[model samples]
Each structure stands twice: as structure tokens, then as C-alpha cells.
Target: MVVQQYRDGGGARAVRALAVAGVIAVTAGCFGGEGESGASDGSGRSVAADRPLDLLGRAADVLVEAGGAETRTSMETAAGGTRVTIRGQGAYDFRRQMGRLKVVLPEDAAGADGHRPITELLAPGALYMKNRGAGVPDDKWVRIDTTALKDGNLLTGGVTDPMAAAELLRGAADVTYAGKSELAGVTVHHYRGVADLGRAARAASPQSRGALSAAAKGFSKDAVPFDAYLDEDGRLRKVRHRFTFSSEGPEVSVVSTLLLYGFGLPVTVTLPDEDAIYTGEIRQG
Candidate 1:
């Protein structure tokens, strides 16, 4: 067995994340049965392609009418080419004044018991991560704080910037009408999008100008562009993306599983290592 014992330290968190990422990709692949290579017919044939969307820009407008949560798995690779996977659970609830998501690792994750993870709430523009575990504090979590992270659903958060997430996919090509398939039982049409990190870094921040100035400087030169596959309808089912760091190439495989389609308002996020919980009335403005 390739047992990587991660002792408590700076490297422990990263190692744990990387190990779990590998397992989740393998597991998600088995569950959805979708991939870059579209499904074939009995005659060894593939589905026909759809027309390009130059008129409206993208093949479809998932962000056209926003009001629900979208959930899926996520995999992020490192600059040194290390793959890290996370079972992403996310939602978009404008009504709740928030859109949020969380990634949970399966049992096999090296430090599954020690690594702290939690919600980064988009409602109040505050970070929310799960830190309350077997014996951990409730506030400790690896995070990047951002008010825009709470602005809109991550799916369309960069909608204004078509090529924003292009660099997220490394050494990968975008396929238009690559094929049609079902994810979480929902049929969606697929399209591939790409943008250079240099170009992406120049795009304006949808929320504000000052923040964009700060974020633009740190943009990586080689962020892998992502391959987003949608069903016949218009929902993002899967993204074949690997982090392409200026240092490392395509390093992670992320498969997103979207369930309970629609908004996750009053979304029920399960607490780890616990079976009991409670809540008070959701005070809203």
C-alpha cells in the first residue's frame, strides 16, 4: 500500500488534500461514467455536434436566470504537479442572500481525521470552513478570504469574464458538442472554453476594481484551462480540469456530482463526525 503518513505540519495539510483528491476522482468516475471521450453507440459511433454560440458568446447561458444552488466535485493540482481532489458540495441561493459550497474527502484521505474543512459562506461575504471535528477548533481551516466568493455561484461567478476559469484546465482542449449525457440524471449539452492566464488576469473583477488590482498581480502564468461538459439542457455536469501551475502541468482530475438540483436554500450541510445537530430561525434582512 502507498501509505503516506502525514504528521501534523505545513506539509501535512497539502499531503492529505492531495491523497484524498486521487481517491475522489477514481470514485466519482465510477459513479457518473462520464469523461472527455464522449459515450459511443452500438455501432461504435458518437453523437452529433451542436452549432457554436458566437451570437451569445458561450454555448449556453447558465447564469442567465440565477436562483438556485449547483453542486459538483472539484479537483485542484499544485505547481509541482501534485493532484488534489475534493468532493465538492455547493449551492446558489440568492433568496437566502448567499451562494455556497463545500468539499469533503472520503475515508481514505490520509489525514481525513485531522484535516479541517468547512463552509465559506457567500451570504455575509465571510469565510465558513468546517473546523469542528473529533478534537479540533471550530475556526481553523485552510482558506482564501473573499467577499466576491460570496457574490454569486462559482459556476457563473466569472460569467462576465468568459475566459476567467480557462487556465484551470491544463494541457486540455475544449470540445464543443463533445457529446450529450446525463449527470445526476440531468441531460446537458457540453462546450469547451479556454483563456490564457495572462489574459484572464487582466479581466476586471465583477465585484470591484481595487480587489482585481490586488488579484491580477499574483495570477499564475500556466493555469490549466478547464473542460466543462454540460448536458443537453444547460447545466454544468463535469469539468475535466487540472491545475497548470507555472511550475507543474496538468496534475489533478476533478469530477463534479450535482444532486438535489435547484437552490440549496436552507441547504442542509452535514456536519462531519457527528449525527446530531440543531438550528435556530434563519434571521434575514
Candidate 2:
């Protein structure tokens, strides 16, 4: 962490500048067993290739066959002089482009009474959010017509889709095998590399693609540093990435971790009642 101060020309006013770097760790939770684990056969076979890019491709294949996965993501961000932390748990159906999620907010983000978790359900054409205990009607859910979005705003909302995340695994550089380790009671291979954000932006979800495209204009084309773990079945158990972005003054650093599991398992998603939905509501940052 580093901080700098600048005195305005009036001398009576002063402005402080800060730059912070942090690593946010996201924990993995099991839903149901659906597939095997590891890049190499559990018996005694060794990895044919140690390249991170190659291993990512194998992970991508396994994810495709698995259909979708359950994930828990946590992010900590600091910019200017403020810091915010967000954590969420969810399940996404890659093939169906659907998901259900619950996001936990920090105490500082609470309303007049207190903070309450927000529940969300997303699908191809629609998105619904329910803010439990937020002084709203019990059955009143907010709905957004996803197909009507002219610009992809939903993707940039800090939600990670399993398929979108898998697509961004390509074009890795500075690959290094960090050896093997135990993740969630299972032995796995650990690897680290730089993620190609340009490629990732193009492959991410529509909202993320648009957000990345705009954000990229103000930053370098350098790859973001990332770490990943693969199981015996060549499946990606966890992946983490961290990067800093700057434009004119303050710089903001973001750390994102994605966990993939419950492969080939069933994910049941039921939308809210139409009569109970408020279609005009929008989430505010």
C-alpha cells in the first residue's frame, strides 16, 4: 500500500492520492459430485504438457462437457480513498445461459436499518433480483429485460458466468507450473500465468465484453497475472487473477477468483412470479 498527498494551488485545500494492491481469495463450496478430477490420471501418470495454456484448454473441454457449475466469488477493491468488499454465491448453467445467485454486502453498504443480502436469478432474456428484508414487498422482485439492453451493463456488475469464464482461458503467457497441492481435500496441479485481457474481453459475456472494451482503452495491453488449479480429470477447480488499472490519477486494483465444480450436476432455476415483479427497477451502484 502507498499513499501520496498533493496541495492545491489555493494552499488551503489538499487532496490525497492512494494506490493499493490486494489479493482477494474466493472459497470453493461443493454442490454435488458429477465428474472426476485432475489433469493427469490419478494412478501414476504424469502430465504430458506443463504449459498453462495447454492445461487451460483441457480444463475448458472438461467444463463444456460438465454443462455448468456452482461458484463463490469474492472481490476487494480500493480506489481514491475508499475501499469496498463484495462476496457472492451462485450457480450457472453454461448451456442454458441461466443462473441463480445471492450477494452479501458489507455493513457499510446497508440501508437505514441494516444490510440485507440480495438474491438474483438470471436467464437468457430476463434478469430478476430480490432484495430480502430491504423494506420491500415479500414477493416483489425486480426484473430486467436482458434482450432489451442496448449496452451490456449486466456483465460488468461483478457476476461471473461459468461459460464466460471458461472462454477467457485462452492466450496465456508467462506460464509456470507451481507444482501440486491439496484443494478441498483433493490433490491438484497448481499453475500460474498472465491472462490475455484482450482475448478475454472478446470472449467474456456481452456486458463484460463491452465493459472491458471501454476500460481497456485507458490501460495497457499487458496480461493480468493469474493462478489456476487442475484436478485429475483435467477439470479446473479454481482460478484467480489480479490486476491494476489506472488512467489520470487514482489507480484501482481488482482481484477475482473463480471456482468450478458440480460438473454434470443438475441446477434447478425457477423465476419469480410475473405478477410480483417490478419490471422498471434497476440496480444502483
Candidate 3:
């Protein structure tokens, strides 16, 4: 698939901002307050002390076992001194490594509303985006190879792939139990740690390894700080990751958050036909 180029202009700037800003965000007021500490039971404490890494490493597996779930994602970052937020709602089939998301970008500089939401299809190694708004045809979908992206589609996709986010836990290190918390009325164990991208790539499943490997080399640092909340069943309910992107200018900070619920939900995602994909060059903005 050919990468869509952007033509220079206000529209192009908005598109570029979406691409760069999609890669990172800060989580502020995205979740409920952290409940009081020391709320875990004896068993929970034992598990936390004995094998936090082991438990965290299996987050993806737990999701897979649960079949599918609904997802909500938030990406927030600052651009040109103004804060931008991108929100997404979707559903994922963990067993098939397929999902669909409706991603809404922030208003443009002029504060104009009514920008169409982008539809994103998530597959094992590819990302399909429609309504991308870089001069591409309305019916054409832009296909991107996740493994080819520097950030491994994590940051580039606006919202991090939920499964990829879980697989990242495979590299959890220096993990510490941060007490207990309530997320949407469910009690969960809160854990904080830094994940090594290289290690995560090696430990991730075949479907996620390549993209994670790309991200390991793409980011300024391989160690990603995170906070994770898991339910009693060891399933991840919510996770927040902090990432930094650096270029010729100052480093850009990003915080990406994913929340999962309604396990066992039916999720169906169909990839577009080859003819439906946009193969033409997208002019740079």
C-alpha cells in the first residue's frame, strides 16, 4: 500500500498534526480517582508480591480467553500551544486479532466543528483507515503496514491497539503493586512499572512481535512507564502508557489510555478489498 502524502496548507497541517499527535497524549481526568491503598486481600497481596510480572505477562492471554470486549481509547497531546484530544470507541476480538474503531479528531485551528470521524480497522500486521482526510477519496481506505511503522502503529494509529498494549506487559519489569483502585465500580489491583520494548517484542506473540520490534527501535527510549489495573480474574480492565517522541525539535510527550469492558461481546471486522484501498500518492501538506 502506498503511503498517503499531504499537500501543504491549513488542511495539511491538520492532517500532519493528527498523524504526529495521534502518536502521543497525556491522561488527565480520563479515569476515576484512585481508591485508598492497602485494600487488596491476603491472596491478592501474595500474588502481587510473589509474581507480579508473571500475572501481568498473561494479560493478553486473559483477554484472549475472554473472547472479545468493547473498548474506549483516549489520546491527548499539545500542538502549537493548544491541547488536542482524540477519542475512539470500538470492539476487539482478541482470538482473531481483529477490531474496529471510530476515531474522532479534535477540531481544527479555526475551531470549526463537523470533521468526519475516521474509521480504523485493526488486523494482525496492518492498519486500515478511512475518512483520513488527506485529500484521499471518500471511499478509499489508506492501508498501512503496522510492522513498517517506526512506532509500530502504536502511536501512528491515534489510539494504541488494545491487544498490543496488553502484549507490552510481557516486558514488565521493576513492577510494584500500587494498592487497589475502583474503575467503573469494579475493584482492581493497580500496578506500576516500566516495560522494555525490546523485551516486549521478544516476548510478544507472533502476531504482535514485528510491530513491537519496530517500536522498540522507533521511540527515544525503550523503557515505557505505565499504570495497569487488572480484575480478580487477571483480566486487564484499564492501562495507561507514557511515551516520548523525539525529532529535530523538542521531544513530544504522549499518554495513551485504553479501557476494556463487556467481555464476551461479539466483534466482527472485515478488511476492505484490494480495490478499495487507496494506492495513489498522498501529497504532503
TM-score of each: 0.50, 0.67, 0.84
Instruction: Write model 3 residue lDDT over 1-285, tens digit each, in one string.
Output: 222211122333333455432532222222111112233456646355456787888888888998899999987754345456788999999999899999987766213577788899999999888876545678877777788776787777788999899999999999998876688998788889999999999999999999999889766689889999988778899999987654443445567899999999999999999889876432212
Per-residue lDDT of 1-285 in model 2, one digit per residue for the tens? 011111111111111111011111111121112233435656564462445566675555566566768888765555566666667788877667677878776665442335567687767555566764323455666555433332122232344444445545654667877877888887778878887756765655564355344333423434677787877766778877665554345555556677776767677888877688643433221
Better of 1 and 2 by lDDT: 2
RMSD of each: 12.0, 9.5, 7.9
The 10-residue segment of model 3 with minimum total lDDT is: 26-35
What residue runs in model 3 are displaced by over 4 Å at the alpha carbon?
1-16, 19-46, 79-81, 109-112, 281-285
| TM-score, structure 2 vs. true | 0.67
Against the unseen true structure, what C-alpha lDDT does each candidate score? 0.34, 0.54, 0.76
Task: Give candidate 1 misplaced runs (Cα > 4 Å).
Answer: 1-61, 76-84, 94-97, 106-117, 123-126, 132-136, 139-144, 147-175, 198-205, 208-216, 248-260, 263-285
- Highest-scoring model, TM-score: 3
Alpha-carbon shift of residue 56 in model 2 (angstroms): 1.1
